[model samples]
Target: MCKALSLLANSQNLFVNLARVAIFIVMIWIGGLKAFQYEADGIVPFVANSPFFSYFYKYEAPEYKNYKNPEGKVVAKNIEWNKLNHTYIFSYALGVVICLIGILTLLGIWFPKIGLVGGLLTAGMAIVTLSFLITTPEVYVPNLGGDGPTPNFGFPYLSGAGRLVIKDVIMFSAGLICASNCASRILSCCACKAK
Candidate 1:
């Protein structure tokens, strides 16, 4: 068993292949959950209510907030979901994009290029989410002195947004692996080289 483990660890191809497989499985799992709304033990709600996901659930539109424009007048208002009609659509679209990126990453069809693009997009989303958090701190705090603190108490430290950031970082690392050593790696793991 130790010999086998050593052999696997020493094989770069095996490591990359395993990374690809693991990434694929994760994509499928997350995509499946989003596509089917699969709820296990009410975990979905808990995740949705998590503080890390607070940005996704509640957005404070610039228009709603009392912010002065260049002319010193309030140009943007504080926009809330109740007043918006397309929030759900936007949310679903973002979800779909994330799932699509995951699927493409799993397939490894474009080697490093596709994975790189996905990673960049994921990073962008994470940045946007972080910006939102910085811009709107109230959404994360408890309202009306509610029961306990929000679900995801340690949001910025380990929220859904943080998870995505980490995932994208891994994806980007994989992309680098593909970009730097794609030719040899593909020759060993994929059938592209045979043709």
Candidate 2:
């Protein structure tokens, strides 16, 4: 039992570091993608469906709901502006924030205070992304991808993007772990110096 516990304790730091690196990689990659117009177009549903985020767009709700994808359905200038906002104003902004969070969290590996701040920001973003589960019905697609039956309401299923959003929960946990470990180590070091 003692040996087993010791082994688990030894592995704890490894898992924490993995989680940290995962957060860093995810943020940097996603943030980089946000810089592209195509990636901006891709996140439309998640942003438009979100009550908190929908207001960011100048267009009305129906415009977004009716907007089609990849079939030459560009109807008006408003749509173009909407896409621009998604790319320039919203997605890019979010991307930068996420990248910053990841960078800060990763920095915690060397600088405890900086890492704690980053951990807090990462945790905050995780909370925001997780909020999409409640606001974005698009997260759940109909069985058969929207052609199953008459009035087939999709529920109890997470769409691909939704699953991606769901992964933030893990990141949130990791942020807490990073912060906790850093704080503990800092306190321990300070205590040893005092003695």
Per-candidate TM vs. native?
Answer: 0.45, 0.80
Query: How well is each residue in 1-195 modelled by candidate 2, as lDDT tens digits?
Result: 999999988998777777778889988999888876566666776777777778776664445655545433444663576665553578788788878988998888888888888888888878888888888777776556454446444565678777888888887888889888778778887999999
Which segments of model 2 are wrong by more than 4 Å? Answer: 1-8, 71-79, 83-87, 143-153
Going through the candidates in the order shown, the clash numbers are 8, 0
* lDDT (Cα, tens digit) per residue for candidate 1, span 121-182: 54454454444434343334333444565644434554443444345555556645543444
lDDT of each: 0.46, 0.76
Question: What value of lDDT does candidate 1 attain over all alpha carbons?
Answer: 0.46
State the displacement of the C-alpha of residue 135, model 1, in Å, after optimal TM-score superposition: 4.9
- RMSD, candidate 1, Å: 11.0
Q: What pairs collide in candidate 2?
A: none
| Highest TM-score model number | 2
